[model samples]
Target: MEIRRTPVLLSWICLLLAVFLIPGHCFYLPGVAPADFQKKDPLQVKVNKLTSTKTQLPYSYYSLPFCRPDTIVDSAENLGEVLRGDRIENSPYVFEMREPKMCQIVCKLTPNEKDAKDLKEKIEDEYHVNMILDNLPLVVPIKRLDQDSPTFYQHGYQIGVKSPHSEGKDEKYYIHNHLSFLVRYHKDEQMDVARIVGFEVKPFSVKHEADGKWNGDKTRLSTCDPHARQTVMSNDNPLEVEANKDIIFTYDVDFVESDVKWASRWDTYLLMADDQIHWFSIVNSLMIVLFLSGMVAMIMLRTLYRDISKYNQLETQEEAQEETGWKLVHGDVFRPPTNSDLLCVYVGTGVQFFGMLLVTMMFAVLGFLSPSNRGGLMTAMLLLWVFMGLFAGYSSARLYKMFKGAEWKQIALKTAFLFPAVVFVIFFVLNALIWGEKSSGAVPFTTMFALVFLWFGISVPLVFVGSYLGFKKPAVEDPVKTNKIPRQIPEQAWYMNPIFSMLIGGILPFGAVFIELFFILTSIWLNQFYYIFGFLFLVFIILIVTCAEITIVLCYFQLCSEDYLWWWRSYLTSGSSALYLFLYATFYFFTKLEITKLVSGALYFGYMLIAAYSFFVLTGTIGFYACFWFTRLIYSSVKID
Candidate 1:
């Protein structure tokens, strides 16, 4: 039975190691559509004349164009041609942006009576208010280059809209907000000129810069709140047909010679569609899922199944000692945990937290919530933490009961206050440091007060209620009854020290994410983007494995030392992961970041609290499960007459 269980556990460990290598193993998939789903480029598109004075296209000059090919629609074309009016023989081909939002109609360079009168009529019709011609800016000339064409020649002029967010709001420009461009080749040289072929909206974005160590720039909109700014539109009629879909006019002209030629669109698009980060994430997620599944199966089959089978075989003899029923050692089980009372509370709180997190993650994976919802992850998790008040209260109260603590009142009071108080103290100190620096990262005084109010008003009451319920229930019964005279403990091995064993347990989980932590910090403080849910999920599995193995190993050592205080050890053994995580964050700030200000440092620690709390919970759950099983194993295997 032991051999079977040992192999199963080993198989799981081997599988975990194998999965950890997935980030480097997989290939990325190509994009299904253009980078942005819309007709416009997500990034700024430029068109420059080879002989032009301007180094880059001015925000004004480049106009978006719609091309009608005789046969197919061109959605994204880097190379385009400028053509002369009506004549195929002498027309000049100039490069232009084929995207609809890039399109613009310019007035003639030297206005005739027809041009001047037409301009006045067009401005009045477009703006519905008189606009001055002198104020109108001259267009610049150039062509957009794509993969096939490296460069295109200069031309007469180009026209484009000034961005909506340009320094001045009063400028008069006929911005085509909802327009998308498409190109379709003419079916025949003599058919109806050309019809609108493709449709899509323009992509837009505002500029942002990181400010100082904390990177809080109030001038820019928060990424956390995407809808903070307003967008301008071309028309007042909400139901007005969009430009790409609603074509107002069409005209046919002779085709002129252009340098651009059709290339294999597949190769062009595939190159642009690849996302390395997303590729890595998918592969990593697959490996971790397989790894964890294997580990879980091995543990259940080898250890748990064997223990249950052995116990079942002895049912007749075990039934004879009905008073025992495996947990006759209730007195020893309640032995006081060594070290500190505060640490006990801390570990218990962590256990409760981990329980909530697992349930939340499972829900998220099942599609109850998505990662795309910015704060939806944090918000869902916070609600789960609140709901777990019961577990915190129960674990703390029951452990205290086992310590021969007759003061249920004191136990209950401490159970209710300990975790919350520690959190508040840590938070208050960090906030004070932030307030001193006047950093944007500092929590507003009102917000701090509200947080306090929530803690006391909401969490404290729930915890107190949980404590009341926990104490109302009977203390947990131990499997083997304790002897009136305590048994002599055998001399422990050198590694049996609680501190030493715990340190070993922490290493696996920390090793799993030590490298990934830098990237996580970069995303948060350095303003780098990371949406690698797969890597995150893998780290999560590693944390579980580390917690369980470490706890089991430590529980064995504690049992050998005759320290029946395995209850608290089991909780704290895994929970030490939180401490390691906090240490890692501190190290990351000093080694990886250039952050100098104390407030940013304080905010960093403030963020660490959230991580620490999460780690504590996750590790705590691992310890609890491991110790629970270990205890059951020993009770079932030991000879009891």
Candidate 2:
């Protein structure tokens, strides 16, 4: 029995894991707590004054004083007490709960801190509630200087908060908490602006956190969430600073657990998982395995066998069928793709991108970048994309030379400029739109100039080198020559046209994640949390499979129709996915997203263009290779005079 080793084993394992194990064990941001810190030497400090404090904190906050004693004191013994007693019922406020529960709370401060503390005492005296006073870590100030203007500063630091649970084991912890700070300024300007700048998750986690629980041994703490670090500013004098400096940044934490517990059940597994991103990634990885299996099987078993047998037969008989498919088209196999210069540049860039995707997926699968890694994945992808310009130039020049395009200097120049120019133009326009909205994600002007500099300095040299190598290599020789007379065109149905079919092929995949697209768009435009890599990963798989299969089917039709112009068809068909992506964004604007016209329209189309162009090159490559092989195989089988 012939054994298919690589894909069969890999794909089967992936599929089983996804179907049976993923749903339960693949939480997004799992085991995200700090290491358990035992008091090495308990500070001999007395609570000079025992005061209970209650303040309405933001609903999104999911932290508490876990490290050191803080300004705010609670009446309850533990966090559960505050949730059960002080929470309002059926109120419009964010923290307003039904009788004694709050679903979504973005914190609303009650009376003054003293009044709130008095209320806490009254509630405790009348009805007993568990109140616990926990100490928190000290906040460190950080500053980010504008490279262009050093004087102007953007202050921010990495916020590291640890949940009160062990690193690996799934356990529940308290959430209703607030950070109280008393800042004494040594010296300050008479008038200056002060505000909380930015906060981000740090990469200190040793293990993944399932849902919100820390998983692993109790002796160790998960670094998934260290602390919330923020850059604060103020121009208030020392007296005012001290008076109001007892600033309480109240917040609540999310406790990830299930009402019912099962050791190995799906729900329990999911509960123990990290975050929603893991769910999407698992699905995406499974689909990719499926896709690779199908494609490899076709290549190794069906296509390879047929091609080898035909080659042997042709040599022995010295005669072949007239209707040989791919074999008959060998001469044109190395023909320059349309828009040779542009195509060369794109393809070269695509090679680099392909490498990045492989590396990223491997890293992710290896657990260095589980779904719980937050922006680590995006940061990696961004760096990879920026650095892959060399591949774009190289692949483009090499392919162009293979196709007998000899304008080396021009091809190199085009390759160097194609991606950087287009991206810069698109990004600039998007930044302009973002300028109006005051969105932080906008690429700054200095960064844009730096991009230009890099393109000229880095990409240009690489392209020149790549073109030199490509030109130095000999042109690929074809096994067969094109006949003087063109084959008669066959009548085709409406659906057979490349344009129409490409449009049709992209619809289903787009539909599958149109709802998901809104979440992504909102993150980019409205600055919402999009840490759902699992969902994004799933959508990516759907997109790739849909593009590949749809393009392949379309290319097959064009070939059967005797349309030798199958080159562009393969590309455009797969590229049509970009069009659908754009269309979905447009639809999202009207139905799902809420944004002004300037930010909405510009960013929408700007990103669309990039997506479309990238898809065009990727899909085109797949189609061209597929059609080329098919043509060569069929043509080679034919008898020649």
- Estimate, for each residue in 1-641, the C-alpha lDDT of model 1 and write its tens digit: 22223444533443343245432111111111112122221222222211111111111111122222223322221111110000011111111222332222111023345433433323222211100111111121123556563323122221223324434434332323222222322122343222222111222211222223321223221221223223212222221112222212111112222222111121211122124554454445445445544665665577546645655566566453553222344346534546535544665576567767677654443323332222455556656776676677766666656555555556556756766677777767775664564322345566566556756676666666766676677876656666666544456677876677677666555655655665666655543233443345556666676567657656654654566667666776766767888898988777876555455555577768767876775677577767777676667554454
lDDT of 2 by residue, 212-256 (tens): 442222211121123312211111111111111122222222212
lDDT of each: 0.44, 0.44
Candidate 1 lDDT (Cα, whole model)?
Answer: 0.44
Range of the 10 consecutive residues with the lowest summed lDDT in candidate 1: 79-88
Deviation from truth (RMSD, Å), model 2? 18.4
> Where in model 1 is the C-alpha error above 4 Å?
1-334, 339-344, 362-374, 402-409, 557-565
Clash number by candidate, in order: 33, 85
Residue 2 Cα positional deviation in candidate 1, in Å, after optimal superposition: 54
Error of 2 at 508 (Å): 5.4
Model 2: number of clashes?
A: 85
